[model samples]
Structure formats: structure tokens, C-alpha cells
Target: MKMNMFGLFNKKKSDTVSLPYTTDIHSHIIPGIDDGSPDVEHSVALVKQMQEWGVKRIITTPHVTEETFENTPETITAAYNLLKEALGEDAPEIIFSAEYRMDENFLKHVKNDILIPLPGNHILIENSFLQPFWDLKGLIYQLQLKGFNPILAHPERYAYYYDEKEIYTDIYNSGCMFQLNWLSLAGYYGKETRNIAYWLIEKGYVDFLGTDLHNRRHARAITEFLQTKEYRKLVEKLNLKNDTLK
Candidate 1:
């Protein structure tokens, strides 16, 4: 269980810094459930890496898309239990929820009240990348009516809303909180996504910061970015709610 021997943690203590927030609200570390870790071994490695990076608790959110992941509570729980068993006492505190796509399937879950939420009843949701969801505001209102706090996951990655930036404000005003992907700030997606990430920070629209980590490549990029001056500055400017989730 010597997690420090893995990844960037092997660097000199002065050369590396722990994440500001102890609770990581978004990640894909659950094994074999979605596009995250492929199995229990990979999940253990990823969790150990996060532990070295100062993550005390992980709220691993697997994708619950309609046609793609189609994850159910039973499936997610089984995978989560497997991961926990593999890690034993060496693992960081782990909880399981799902990143729900805003679609008919999710609406059905809402109707059935089967959706898993983060601490404080906050639910992470995403929009279709190909196009904006119609009546997204209404959907947010519906979630709110059902007593769930809906947080739009990685708003910067949605290219359709780039030109119509006013929609961002509209969505915020409609009471949907925004979660910014930490990798987006590292320019992992591209220049446009980085720009929007900063833009959200400047406008004070970003309420939560998530790793959105999918693999080892993402872990390396995020680890490198964490030590940069830009990352330091960005965190100072952000009023993130990640700690509140604990």
C-alpha cells in the first residue's frame, strides 16, 4: 500500500503539491462499469494515485448514458463493491454515483426516483455533445421540483453553447449549478475548451471542480498541470464547492 511509489508522488515533496480539496467529486475509477477503468486492478492503481495526490475521499461517477453505458444501480454497486474489495483498507474513502446524461432515460430514472446523488442531493448531469438538449431549462426545473440539485457537468466541453454564450447565463439563472472539468483548464480538450474554462472562472460560474479522469493519461496530465502557476492562480480565483460535498 505504498501509493507514494506510484506516479508523480515519487517526486520530491517540495516538487509536488496535494490537491486543494480533499474530496474529489467527479471521476471514473469504478472498474468495468463504463469508459473508466477496465477492471479492478486498474481501479486500484487509479485510486492509489489519487490517494497520493491528497484525495481523502472519492465520489466516483460512472457514466449512465442511454445507449452507451446504460448503467443501473445494481451494476454500479456490484462494480463498486468489487473495487472496494480489491483495495481493502488501503483505498481512499470511496462512494459511488453516476454521471447522468440529460435524456429520456434519465427522465425515467427521475420518475422512478432511482437516481443516485452526491452529498447534499447534488446530481451530476451532462448534455449531448452533438447538440444542445431541447428545453434544458425545463429539465433543470423538473429536477429541482423533484428536490434534486442538478449540476451541469463540464459545461466548457459543449461546443454548441460556445457561440450562444448567453445560454450559459440562462442555465445558471435557471438554477442549475456548473461543474468545470479540471482537465479542461489544463487545455487537455483544446484551446477552445480552455478558454471557456477560464471564462467560467472569470464569470464566477464554476461551482465545482472535477477530475473527470478516465485513464492513466488523464492522471499524468492532471498531475503535471497541478504544479503549474496557471493552475495555482485558477484555484485561488475559484470558489469551489468540492469540500462541501464531504
Candidate 2:
């Protein structure tokens, strides 16, 4: 296999290196919910793999989009409960949260005060793939006013921002933290995303690193990436905020 930015292959490790964050704050491990794990078996299997990766706790963030997923709190909790029952006591500690795609659905949830915040009252929010939310800043302000720490999910994946990259700093300055996808550094999403990931790290704007693990493919990619030197360097330099959540 060809080694990409993360030293994915063509490199040998002298010793094992684990991620700095023990609790993964972003993932889609709740089965039959969204675009993540498909069923209970897959959910348990993915959690086991996460445990193998040294994740002591996992806060799975399933998608809650309008019309598309429309996953409610009751639905998410039921899926979480099923996974918990399937895993018994051997599974890694798990928590249920939703990846809010700053859309009308999210706005309704926010207004209703039903959005599930991650540790420290942090809300993991993202933009639409093609464009950002028009009232993104205002939404962040509202979230903050309501005592929710707004976390922008996978800013590098927003291709629109590649041209106007200064928006990243603007978002960060607006008091919203950035969550980087681990696959981006591994060149899993392609070189552009990988370069942006490195750039964000170098610029001191990366606040969190999330697996964003949706299935076995993502789990395998992260497993291989962790064996690379770049992974260790990122863990050492980023000073990730996941520890605070624990």
C-alpha cells in the first residue's frame, strides 16, 4: 500500500502509540440510526474496535438531519439502549449525542431545548456539504447564550472554505471550537483534506480530533493511521480538549 500524509504504510513502528484522547466525542456507532453502524452486531463490533484503539469512553454522535434522518431523542436513546444490551458489561463506556447539521431541524431542537449536548454542554454542529448555514454565527451566539459550547464538526471537509479559508479563523474567533476528523490526516478523504488538516494543526486551531467512525472501513483506516509517526506527532502537539470531557 502507498503511504500518504499520515505515513499510512511503508513505515514501521518501534513502539505503539495511543491517541491522546481517551474519550471519542464524535462517532456514529448507534445502530440503525443514520449513516453509521447498520445493526446491533455492527454497533457492538465497532465499539470493540474502538476499545482496541484505547478508547476508554465513546460519545457516539449520530446524525440528526431534517427530512433525511429526522432522528429524535427517543429514537437515538432506544438505539443506544439496544447497543448497550448487546454489549453487556465488556463494552466501552458509551454516551448518546447527535451531530447537528445546522438546519431547520436543528433550529427547532435548539428552540425546544431538546438537543443533546456533549460533555461540558458542548454542541457538535456542522454545515451542509455544499454550503454553510446563513445564520451560523448567530446560531453559535444563541448556543453560547444558552450555555452550550458550539463545536464545528470537520471544518476541513467543507470544500467551499478551501477558497475562503480565513472563515476558519473567523469561526474560531467567534468562540466555536473546531473538531478535526482523524481520517483527514490519513488522507482518507483525499489530499486536500489532509493538507487542510495539517494546516489547521499548524495554525493552532484544532481543538478536538474525532474518529467520526461510522463503520468498519473507518475503523480500519484509523487503526492503520495510528501506527504512523504523524499520528503520534499530532497527538503530542494538538493538546486536544477531549481530556476535559472526561
Candidate 3:
């Protein structure tokens, strides 16, 4: 991934920038889970890193895709327990949730009421890159009827929707919230994602800002981004909904 001169500057901040949120509501830090930490030690390390970045709590979200991850509540809980045990007493508060993909299996789980949600019944959902879900609007309505507030994770990363901003507006109008990946602002993904992220922020459409932290590399990027002036301004300007999870 290419980054600008600002993102390349990695010196530790002389003055602290107060993080906007007391809690980070999205991540993949549970050990041995999906594509996140490979082991307990790495999971603990990531948690500590987030703590240093001023996040008081984290709700790690593992992928629960049908074809790939296929994670269940039982599996996620076991992993969370293992991570919690490894952290001992000094670690910040940790919670567990799943980033659900809108597929047949997800619909089954939704109907079964087996989904785990954030503090406010907020359930994170993502789309496939191949194509948008055909009934996304209806699905959001159904999720709301089932008492789950669906949050679209990293909407900027969906390149297909970039051509039409109204699609995002329609999704939001359907009662689904948007979560902006913190890495997007650092150009960790690319310039297109970065531009879309800022555009969403400018339109007051961003409801949450998440680390989406998977491993050390992503952690380092977030740490570097936080050191820059732009990141601090975003923290103030967006007024992200992460505080609601606290």
C-alpha cells in the first residue's frame, strides 16, 4: 500500500492527541480466530498496543463467513476466553462480536437469533466484493425488525459503490449505519479508499471509526496515523459513535 509523506513520518508524538472514543467496537484480535492474531501472545500484544493508543475497551470482531471462516458463537467464545486468560489483570476490557457477511448462512443465523451483538445490539455486516447483495435494503429492514442495528463495515472499501454515492445514502436511509476503517485515512488500502473515507466524513455520514486491526502491520499503520495532525482532527470532526459502545 502506498502512503503520503505525512503517513511516512513515524516519530512518537511529543503531545498526546486525546482519542475520540473510549471503546473501539470493531477488530479481529481474538487469538486463533479468522485472519487476526495467530496466538495468545500476539492477541495480548495487540490489545496492549490499542491501550497505548488510548482505547479503553475493544470489541473484537472475527469474520463469520460461510464459505471461509464459518465461526460460531461457541468457537468465538472459546477464543475470547483464551485471549482473556492470556491477558491476565492488566489488560483493557475485551468483548466479542462477529463481522457477519450477508449470505445464506448469515440469514439462517439471523433467523435463529444466534448472533452476538455489541453493547447496543449493533451487529457489524460486510458485503462481498464480487457483487452487492441483491436484497440489502430488505435485509437491513429484517435485521432491524429482529432488534439488531446493522452496521456496514468499511463502506469505502466497496469500490463498486464508489461511482454512486447515492447507493450509500440509500443504505443509510434504510437504517444501516456506516463504520469507517481507521486504516483508510492512512492510505493503507489505497488512495481511492482514502478519498472515499474523507468524503464520507465530510458528508457527516460516518457513524463509527474502527481500527479493523488484524495484525502487527495494521497496528503499526494505525499508530503512525494517530501521530499525524489529520488523524487528531478527524477524531474531533467525526465524533464517532464508538463512545456509545462504552
The candidate that achieves the highest lDDT relative to the unseen native structure: 1
Q: Cα miss at 235, model 1 (Å)? A: 1.8
- Compare candidates 2 and 3 on lDDT and give the better one: 2
Which candidate gets the maximum TM-score versus the true structure?
1
lDDT of 2 by residue, 18-87 (tens): 6777899999989898999888877777776776677899998999998889998899999999999989
How do all models score by TM-score? 0.94, 0.92, 0.92
Distance (Å) between predicted and true CA of 179, model 3? 0.5
Number of clashes recorded per candidate: 0, 0, 0
Question: What local lDDT score does residue 179 receive in model 2, on the 0 to 100 scale?
Answer: 95
State the lDDT of candidate 3 residue by residue for 103-200, as single tens digits. 99899999888998988899999999778888999999999998889999999999999999999989988889999998999999999999999999
Q: What is the lDDT of residue 158 in candidate 2?
A: 93
Better of 1 and 3 by TM-score: 1
The lDDT of each candidate is 0.88, 0.86, 0.85
Q: For model 1, how does the per-residue alpha-carbon lDDT over 118-164 read when each residue is reduced to its tens digit?
A: 99999999999998788898989998998989999999999988999
Better of 1 and 3 by lDDT: 1
